[model samples]
Target: MINNVRRDLNDLPQSLRNYLGVALGGAGLVFWVIAVRESHFLNMNAYGLVSILGWPFFVGLALVAAAFTVELFRAPLRSMQLTILIVLLVLFVFGTPCAVEPVASLTSSWVHAGFIQYIVQHGHALNGYDARFSWPGGFSMGAVLVAFAGQANAIGFLRWFPLFIELSYLAPLLVIARSSGVSRRAGWLGVALFYSTNWIYQDYFSPQALNYLFFLVIIAAVFACWQPKPLASYGPQSGFWRPRLHQNRNLLTRSRWEGLDTTSTWTSAATLWVLGLIGIIMLASSMSHQLTPYVLILALGACLLTRRLGRPEMVLMITVLAFGWLSLGASDYWVGHLNVIFGSAFQVSSTIGSNVTGRLLGGLSHVLIVETRILLTGGLFLLAGVGFLRRSADSRALEVLAGVPFLVLIAQSYGGEGLQRVVLFGLPFTGLLAASAIFPLRTGAIKAILPAFSFGRFARFAKPTVRMAAFVVVLGFALATTVVRGGNDSYESFSKGEFDAVNFAYNHVRPGQTIESVNGYLPVGFRGIGSVSVTTPAQRSSTSVRRVGLRLLRDRPSEIILSQSQQLFGEEVSGYPVGWEASLESTLVNHGYIITAQWRTATVLALTG
Candidate 1:
């Protein structure tokens, strides 16, 4: 029966196949629109966006994945059709949250907006205000944009920034994928996989998002500018054994090293110009985000070691710039918090524990989401390993690039998000390698490093099996990503009511007065900079409502803003009892607090005279 279906599909005319692909993408878009219209943020539960998202969203995602897979398998692939399908898939995966939510999500996005606003208003970063402000290039750039657009603040740019930035990433990603020494089909599929599996929420409006763009552009430039020179095989013909010291020395001789060096067709002037641009981007990245510069250094070093980079000086330039900014420009951040900077260096176990184990403690739904993330990451790496064994390539550059990001895990944990960042930095290469498992080249510029595993009898059914595998893998990732990507939206995503309440508090509160909340999940910081302060007490499930009220009373904050998102966070993540916010609000009212303002999803309480 499967063979018959495959035969029928193969018999379809090229025009009909193209139409089918277009139809699938159109249907997927329609379903996605329906899903967005059907979704209600207020209805979201512990399962996060998935809880509120209906079947249409999943159907839409599946359709888009199917369309891409079908296009991927077609003879003489339709690049335009595949591009449209991938864009639709990206929309389904990344743009849904922006479309469904009332306002821009994530507290850090709002804070970053606040930083940009401060820069726009004052023309300088507020000193000693925020650790993030010490590296202010992104915020400064945003301020320039705001001025260029004649916008009063950065709020106008926040809501759809993720979608815009993600779409922007696709260009560099395409360059990287196409130039990464993979088959054209594998490169396109790898690009799709990169988007499908990118559940990391760092694309929100922040320095990291912009720096990530810089990261991609730098790597893409390197790949486009250089290709590895062909070298003779020196390793064992079979089995996993190390080469002898003499063979290794022979491999490293001046002639051999020259053979290993990368070559470029571009003129030296063009190469120097591109390198200078890359340097500027590195400088900007170093001043924009603390971590990406080091990641770039590591990536450049990986390229250099793997003979994919023509210029070795690029790595040193980034390293010096990254640390130089740390010592000079960002002194305010690391001056006193040196331990925070280097506290976890070489503490691999502790870093892993913090990055992985610490994140596992939450509600069942949250735990499931985290587990899915881990599984997705592990699954990609596992597939990449198979590809590495099966693939024929000129250089082991992809393998090195994919593996080198892990070294960042040993240096600093990046506040428990290091692992996620590592996964992201390596995702393009990892996706390519994983795709190679499905569509590996027969041969390349150099002999295979490892003996290629033969499919043997399975080779007869390879085409259909490869199609099915690609479809399953892409669709499975799309579905899983839909769940895990928005898994925190129950608390992380804000509603209009929450926004209104936060605005009310900010407007009514004085410059020196503090606004208190149970958590920092809402849109609170865009308006207030150095003058107004907001505080969220440490969340503890053991703490009673009475104790929370007592702490509020002791702190005597001028106003307290409690919202549905914060309450959901307490119940879902902190393990606090459901309606704990209400209980605490009642306790505060009974003492001396009055409900100064109220909204359907949020309330602001003020102390009564």
Candidate 2:
């Protein structure tokens, strides 16, 4: 049967096969468009985007994965066809939310827009306003973009920012994949897997997103510029019979260090220029984000230890820049909030509890999403480990690069998001290793670190079976990614009505007045920075309508905006009863609050005298 399948595949002309790949890619995109058009935001339920996404989405994803797998096995890979398929897959995975939703998701993205607006209007960052402002490099850059684009504010950039930045990541990703001691097939597969499994929502319109690009570019440059020298072989008489300590000493000798040193074919001037560019990027990263610089430091140290990085001083430079900014430039953030900065240092147990166990507090559907994420991450790492064992390479740089990010957890937890950030930092390398599991190289630039594992006995069965297996695996991950990636869209994504309601509230509410919501899930922060205060039930102990009404009556906010997204968060995540917002609205009306404005998806209540 397998032979028949192989013969059938081989019978097709090369041009026909190329045309077929393109046709499948186009069909997948068409199906995705149909899926997006059919999806209704109101239909989304506790299962999040999967509840609203139709069958066409899955069909589209499967076809794209199949096309990619077919291209992977072609005799001479058509780079153009592979590129088209990969981009289409990226669109299906990362661009779906951008297209289906009426407004950009994430209140934080909206808040970031507001920060950019502040910089554009005030000619500088607002001091003593936000901890994020202390790291104002990205915002400053956004301000420039806003002015250059002739846009009044950064709001216009919010809706499609996630997709744009994710697409931008592909350039550096290509470099890293091709240079990181992997076969061409594994490199391409790793890139696809990276996009397929990237459920982390950090790619929104934020500093971290830009800083992440810097992270990738820096790593890519390092890998591209250098290759490790072959290690020298030791004779049995020299150290085979010596004490373990003596053997260890021999391993640490200056000659050994020279052997581990990396060499590059680039001219001296070019090397110097690349080093300078890396330093500038590191400096910018240090100023733009609190955590990425440190992550970069760890990644560079890993490379140095594994002999992939030739310059040890690069680590010192980034560390100094990161700390220098923290102490001198971002003093406002860490001075009074020292505990917020270093309180969780070395508290691995508590950090894990907060990052993992505490996050499992939502409803069953949410629990399923979180559990799926955990399992997917664990499964990817396990595959990477298997790849490490199966593949033969000169250095273990990929393994070290993927593993060292965990060390960040010991230093600081980054407000329980430490693990997620760790995963993000390690994801590219992990994807490479995972791809090696499926399509490993038998030899590289130097002696193999491990004996190459052979599947020669099953070679006949392997091609057909492995192709099908690869297709299934990629298809499964794409499907699962579509589910968990948008699993929070129930509350995270907003509608046109919600956006309009928040705009209405912002325009009417005066300075010193307060705006309140059932929760912090609404799109409310794109305007009204320090002048108008906003509050949510996130800190409240009870979410009961009566309890919430009592608290609101006492506070007497000038205006309150309630939206569908916030309501869904109350019901789905906080486990409040369905229609809880309606009951809360009634309770507010019974008091001094009057319905001043209303939309299909949102409402505004004014505190009437």
Candidate 3:
């Protein structure tokens, strides 16, 4: 039966195989759409990826992955294009259909859109609007695009922006993977692993997302200008270095420290042009994001250390640009609050305790999802380690690239998201090394074949069976990581009704009227620029809730708004227990506040005499 299946498979035309692959992938997408469309958000598991439709989706992914592996091995030339399409299908097709209203995935998406709305309407960043606005390049760019498109506001773009940003990453990532010294097969698998394991939601429409693209593009360009040596050239060389005491005499001398330089694709003049282009990108990134510039600087330093980059002056130039932007353009954010900038530097324990350990306090389902996420990340690193051991000669580029981002971990907490940012910045490189684990560069025709194991008496069947198994592994990781990445959507995402309630409140509130909530999860301040004063105390602890309400009452706010989304957010991410919202409501009622308006998802309480 197996022999017959193989014969039948080999007899089919490549066109038929490609068509079958697309058909299977499309069927999976359809199943996912039907499942999400028919199901309600409340019914989602801890991870949003699982539903009655997930099984079919998994089967579909299996078929698609199988198609990718088969086509890659059989017809290596056109495999990348097909594989990229498959990647887009996996990363985007499931999510794009539901992009209109905010998903339970993130509240920041709405908040970011609000920033763009502010920029578009007023043509200026509001003073003390938020720290993100201090570097308003990305928001301003969004504003320009929105204005050019003649859109009413930036809200419509939020749902689909993640997909767009993720797809945009493919080209640069492929370039980086291909030229980073890995073989052709490793490069393809690396790119695929990147999409599969990228559960980080940094691809949302924000400064980080935009700056991350700049980061990738810059790295890709640099690596392109100086591609790594072929696998054979990585062998040892016998060179006499200067005496140990003289080594420190001139640290800038590359020839004395390392061997002869390899040929770069770009001439010295073109290299200068690339460096100038990189400087401009770094400047723009500096204006757009607070963290990515530093990330870029550190990554460039890593490239220099590996001898993959020749321009050492480029590093110092980027540093000046980043710090210059912080001093001049973003002075509003850190001028008086210098402590916030430097307080957590080197305070790794405190940073972790607050950023990581604190957020781990959640319900069982949330805990499970978080643990799964940790395991998934750790598993990737472990694979990279194995790949490092298995193929030591051809991994220096990936290793240095992957390891450099850890420098960010030591610098600052990025307001508890530092680790996440680090993982995201390193993902493209780490994914490359991780792929080397499954498909280490081989010497001959078998170089195309991915790594797979066989048991006793079945070794002869390993080639075909292992190919199918490898695809299965890839598909499984993609599906599981998708579930873990988006699992929090049940509580984190908002509904259109929720947005309507917030919009209605904004329209009704007059300028200077205080709009207060115990938590800032609702879509507020997106429409009304300087029209109202909205306050949600940064700390939303149960003890602080009453204090915030009393404080708002003291200030004589025009309206107090609360919503089901806020309540859920507090319970889930904020560590508030159940019934916290009701208690606050009871407190409001006792203070002579009347319910002026109510929606299924939100409520407005007006202060009465």
What candidate 1 gets wrong by more than 4 Å, as runs, is 233-260, 445-460, 539-546
Candidate 1's TM-score? 0.95
Model 3 over residues 322-385: C-alpha lDDT tens digits? 8998898888888888998998899988777766676675677677778877788888888878
Residue-wise C-alpha lDDT for candidate 1, range 43-69, written one tens digit per residue: 999888888889999899888888888
List TM-score per model, in order. Answer: 0.95, 0.95, 0.87
lDDT of 2: 0.85
Which of the two, 2 or 3, has more TM-score? 2
In order, the Cα lDDT scores of the candidates are: 0.86, 0.85, 0.70
Judging by lDDT, tell me the better candidate of 1 and 2.
Answer: 1
Model 2, runs deviating above 4 Å: 236-260, 444-458, 540-546
Which consecutive 10 residues in model 1 have the weakest lDDT in total?
239-248
lDDT of 2 by residue, 508-602 (tens): 89998989987778887778777888887556424665666677878889888888888888777777888988988988898888999999999
Query: What is the lDDT for 175 in model 3?
Result: 83
lDDT of 2 at 22: 81
